[model samples]
Every structure is written in structure tokens, then in C-alpha cells.
Target: MKKLLCIVLCLALASSLLFACASPAATETTDAAATEATASEAAATEEPAATADEPVTITILRPGDEEKVKSFLEPAVQQFEAENPNITVEIMYESWAGWIQTYPTYFEADTQPDVIFWWDNKLYDSSAHDHLVNLSNYLSEDFFSQIPQGIWDLVDTGDMDGVYYVPNSVDTFVMYYNKDVFTAAGLDPNTPPTTWDELLTDVQTIYDVTGTPGIGIPAITGSEVLEEFVGLFLNQATDASVLDSSSMPLFNTADGLSALTMVQNLSKYAQTSPTEYGRGELRALLRDGQVGIIFDGPWAVPTFKAAYGDDLDNSPIGIATVPLAANGKKIDWAGTNGWIATRESTAAASAKLIEFLMSPEILLSHHIIYGSAPLYASEFDNAAFQYDYWKVFYDEAQNYKLYGMIGRNSATPAAYYTALEEVWQQLVLGQISAEDAQAAAAAAAEGVTARNN
Candidate 1:
């Protein structure tokens, strides 16, 4: 009876041990199922696909007409967006009217765009502030190497200072002439007048043969007036010495009087009284072949091209460097406008956009459409930018000079420009002598400096 009881006890103990071992396996299986269910729920809700709720957008503020933006900028933006699926570009246009008043307000409000198109005017002054990004640290050395060292020097304020802007286009003056008119005048259309004296002779010949005026220069008091006397003729005479080293007006001198006298002499061959012609009228007269020559900027190429078609390059119309001085020295007055990224922007992304826009292919296309000289050095070598009309003025970019105010400490040029304009109109109308014009210009500049002080 004792042996039977012991065997039952042993069997019970073995069963208990087996059940304890099995309990851990069952718990582990249940935990595995729970973890799988939790993972399934997480997969179902895993943050909804990137939608309108979250978008990465870059904004650019530029100044231009809608037609221009649609024609040139929109396509480029579209390509950028297409390539960068996670990013979008929004372009906002500032109106041409009152833009100067409106642009600075954005910075004041701390609402400037990620990228902006700005001129050298007052930008160098602005660079002293913290409003602009320090591009020296952000841009790679290879990128800066692509642009001319002179241009980099043009924008650089100092050795430690940053490059606040990247130039997109450069502009300079050139004389456009009707080759057909030159040919009719018994002058070789292929050989343009190389000196001021030669230009005068050619003008007389064109007048004698064609019975039309030799040249059309704006004599009206406005921006064109200021540009002709102060922008072009003044610089040509003084070798871009419009201002003294001390940043004082230097145009009230013998050189300045000489420049004015030259302008006066040229006026005798004008198609109409300088007062009677505006830039538009002159361009129209030139287009209709009513005038032999007109001094204008590079921006007018498309207008001339449209009027003359293949003849623009073939022969009917041609571009020439402004006639040289007797000493064989020539200087071109130029202005540069460029893209600036604000300190408030995403500098990395804004820089990328500039890099993309300034690429050889993109810049070439933009310059082709805009009719301005390309900002990059290599772009000059590109055949697309080498149309005959372009080459005539394009090479001059190498030897070009910027406006007086391009320097860091130069005074406000526009302040005196109005007075200069009034003086120019008087001179062109024979109301004021060259010496008188210089005196008046000096007084005007003095008044501006006094007011600032």
C-alpha cells in the first residue's frame, strides 16, 4: 500500500514541472501577436503622405514686366520645380513704377524675399548692415572662379566683407547705325567711324547724300539727358573721372567743358532739335531709316532686330563702339544688376537657385531673351550670345567701367542728376555756354552735398 502512494506522488510532481515549463512559451506567443498588431496599426497611420499641408517653397522678388517674366522667368522656374520634387519656387514681381520706394520697405519690414534682383545703387551701403548673407562662407571657391575677378572686386567692399550680390547682367552704351544709310552716303558700311572727327565727317556725308539728319541725340530734360551728358559724354571726356578722388564733382573743369562742346557740335547734325526728340522718337526714326545713327544702350537690340530682321546681322543696321578720342583712349560707362539673397532667407537654398540660374545654359538663354550682356566670363564665348550685334558691344564688357556711385563712399548721383539735366537742356538749346554748363553742374553737385551734410 505504501509503494502505490509514493508512485502517485512522483507522477504528480513530474506533471507540475512540465506545465510550468509550457507556461513561458504560451506567454511569449501572446506577446508576439500583440507586437504584430501594434506594428500593423502604426503602418496604417504612418504620417499621411506629404501633401498641401506641408510644402517647401522658395520665393523670389524681381522687377520686370509680366510679359518678360512669362517669356523668360516662368520656364526656368518650371524646370527647377520639376527637377526638385520636394521644392517649389514662387516669383513675385515688383512694379516698375515706384519700385525704388517699395523695395526698401520690404527690408524695413523684415519681409524681404528669399532672393531679390537689385542694382549696385545703394546696395554697397546696405551691405554694411546684417541684412544680406555673407556669401564668401557659403559659396564654393569653384563657383566664384567662374566670374571675372574684376567683377568680384567691383562688388567686394573689403577683404573681410562678403559678396552681397551676384551680377546677372551688365549694360553699357553703344552707337547703332543704319548700314544702308552709310552705303547710300558713299561711305563704307563695313567700316564705322573710329574717332570723333571721323564721326563728324561721316555725319556730314550722310546728310549731304541722303538729305536726312546725320544723328539723333535726345536733348530733352530727363533721364536720357542725364545719361548722355553725365553718363556717356562726361565719362568719355574725363576718362570716367566725373568725380575727383575725394568724391567731389570733377565735371566743372576744362575736360567737362570740352565734353559739353563736343555734344554741342554733334547737335548741329541732329535730325531735329534736341528738345523735340525723346529716346523713343529717336529709336523710331532710326527704325524707319530716317536717321543715319543713334546712340543707345544694348537693350535696344531686340527692337532693331525685329525691325530689320536678318539684316541686323547681314548689313542694313550695325552697332559700333562709341567713337574714340583723339588720344585713342576709349572708356565705356556700365551698370551691373544682380541677384541678392537676404540674411532672413534660407541661404543654402537661395544660393542653389542662383547657381542654377547662373549656369552656362540658363544664363545664355536669359541673356538671349533679355538682350543684355551675360554676367559670367565663359558666357561671352558661347555662340548663342555672339550674334554680330552682340559682339559689337560684348567685347567692351572686358574694358568697361561702372558708374561713379558704384564705389563705396560715392554720393547720391541722382540728387545732382536733375540739376545736371536742366543744365544740359540749356546747353543743347544754346541758352548756356559749355563753361556755364560746367559752373551750373558744379553748383548743383555742391547743393546736393550741402543738403546731405
Candidate 2:
């Protein structure tokens, strides 16, 4: 998630609860609410109800190292399994912290997963690069083509060698702020900033008048955080790649330097750079009114809604597309989540299942259940997608440039981002000239490239 925005389109399950007859998952204790999947032993003991012809065991694996898999996802699987007797899903959860080691060992073994969970763009690339089965074999062209044009764009990521992935739901980055804080600072809550310049000015104003941070800037999400939006800004101004693997040191262009300088300079106005604190901590600052703005994905909407309520509409919340670079249109850096066949898959069967998953009705249910945006027009039939809060993402989706998790561990990606962070810190700390920091960062990047290469 730190490598790119993972919050947009992630999910599972359907509930049959109708009207007042429903027993929400919340009826359980807090621990059970966290993750209620029955263990293999527990399942054996219960003789649980299942679909007519459930598989002996339908294994599902996902890597997040996040607690949400158990808390939020397990219940969905349980409910689905209850209705589908032949398809009892056995979820194997693992965290991202040790995933680099655990994943290969688990997936490569005889027990490969039938369905998997992943952060859309990053996981797709890693799986594709590793020669995971091409997902195209699992779904039809008509089906893929029919996915809302914008959501489908996420899977392409402009690589085009092959359609290695398909994003099932839609998602993007937006500026989330506390309207009450804005009001206290005498800024207009109804008008969130649209340009990078306005954002800067707003931050300084908030800090000056309210003694609260103007914003929370995160370098931890990696360069893609700024690179995706800024790439559009600068390239529209003058053509450039954030990192050019075509050359030795990746991206060290004048434009690249300028992007870093601009972002780093803003650190002086930010409450804290994200690398110094976990992302949840930063969001908490926004909720508690310590910070006025944070660049986050659609997931923050529900979180703030639950935590603040009327505060969200009155004193508390607002969501808008990420601020635009002067020359670029407002855009989001979105990712995808979908099914992929394994190395020895049966193409026909895989294709059928993929088709089932892509159905519009299923897509709508999935997104609604997870608080995600749907990737197909079929979902818009549900009243939820019509909201203004959701429209911001829909608008951003049209202009988004989906990002892969390439920079997480790779030299070009890491160095380029690290350079941006160090440059920002230096400029904020008044330790080096902007030009000097860019040059030095580029030099250091060259060394990282040579060594990694």
C-alpha cells in the first residue's frame, strides 16, 4: 500500500440480510468482528452448512500483512461459503512484512491458491513478471472490454506487452480534509484547493491562523504519490519519464529535478512528512484536527464518515481529487485487483470463473461491501455510486495513470523516490540548495543503479 495507492478497489462476499431480518456481522464480539473465519478444526467440528457442491477445499491466499484480512474479509468468505456448499473457501493470510520470503515458498508449492487477494497494480506486476499465468486466459475480451473504460485503464499501466492484469473495482488518490479545521482557520470549507499553488497557500494560511499544520505530506507512499500526478504535469509541459531504465542512473532529467524541488519545498508547510510516521497516524491527525489536509485514497471517506458523522459534513470532512500541477489536469494514480489463473490452469474453467466475477451485479455488491468504487457501469445502478463523495474518484479515474509497485524494492524506483525525500528534507531543513540536492541525489541514484544492475 505504501508503494502505491492500494485502497481503491479491494473486496469480497455478499450478504442476504433483508430489511429487519438481518443480523449484521457486528453482533459478534470485537475479536470475532476482527476476523471470523472458521479454522479447519472448527469447520470439522461444526459440520457447517455449505453450497450444494462445494469444493473439498477452495483455498484463497492474499498478502497484506494487514489485520483487515481476518477482521473484514473472513466474514465475507464465510457467508459466501455458507450459501455455496461446494465452494468452502480456506483463506491463507500473510502479512507483507515477511511476504517476500513467504509468498514464493507458499505459491510455488503444490498448494497454489484458487483465488487470491492482492493490492491491484503492484501484485499484478510482481505476479506477471514472475511468469504467473496470464489472466487473459481466464476471461473473455468482451467482458474485459466492457469493464467501465476508466477502471480497466488501471490494469494496463501503459506497459502493453500483454494485458497482465485487470482491476475489478475503481480507486484513486484524493485530498481529505477537516472542514471544521478549515472553517476555524477562516478558509472556505466548500472550496477545496484545485491547484498545487492554491494548496500551498491554503496550508500556509491554515498554519498561520489556526496553529494547525497546513497539510500532511507523505513521501512514504513513494515517488508515485507525486510522480503520477506530477508526471502528467511536467510531461504535459515537457516530455520526460520519472525513471528511465534506458539509461544508467534512471531519471535524472532537469524536469525530474524540478518535480523533486517543488515537492520538497512544500515540506516546510506540512505537519510532518509521511516517512516519519505511519499513514494511519497522519490520518488520525486529520481526524483530530491537528492537520487540515492529507492526500489519501477513497477508503478514507468511510473511515472519517464513521468516526466523525455530522462532523464530516459540518465541522469535519471533505474529499476532493488530488491537487493539480499548474500544467496538468487533475488525475489519480489507481491500481487493480482481480483473478489470475495459475501455471497449470484449465483455461476454460478459469475463464468461466473470471467471467462470473466480472458480472456487473457482483462488481456492485463487492464494492459496496468493501466501500470501494466499482469499475463497471453496471454498478452505477446502485444508488451509492451516485454520491458526490464517490464522483470525485470517478472524475479522477478518467485522468488517472495507474502505477505498478515497481519502485518498492527496485533500484530505479527506490532511488528516484529516496532522492525526492532526501531533497525535501534538505530543503526543509535549510541544509542544502535545491539544485545541489537534486544533483547529489542523482549521483547517489547512479550508484544505486550501478550496484543493483
Record all residue pairs in model 1 with backbone atoms less than 3 Å apart, i.e. clashing. Answer: none
Best by lDDT: 1
Off by over 4 Å in 2: 1-58, 64-90, 96-101, 107-111, 119-128, 156-161, 219-241, 245-251, 272-275, 310-315, 383-386, 400-430, 444-448
What local lDDT does model 1 show for residue 427? Answer: 72
Against the true structure, what is each candidate's TM-score? Answer: 0.78, 0.70
Which tens-of-lDDT digit does each residue in 1-453 have in candidate 1? 899999999999999999999999999999999999999999887633333224566788767776876677788888877766666788887665656667657777877777877765555344224577766666778888887765654553433366778887777678888887888889898898888789888888898788888988786655634445345677777775565533467777677677878777776677766777777778878887899998877777777777766346775777888887555666766666788877533666677678778777788888877777666656668765656667666666656554433233333545555666787777767788878878887787667666756
TM-score of decoy 2:
0.70
Candidate 1 global TM-score: 0.78
> In candidate 1, how many Å is residue 379 off?
4.4
lDDT of 2 by residue, 97-172 (tens): 6664565565656455655554443432333335344556445678867866655544543443545455655666
Best by TM-score: 1
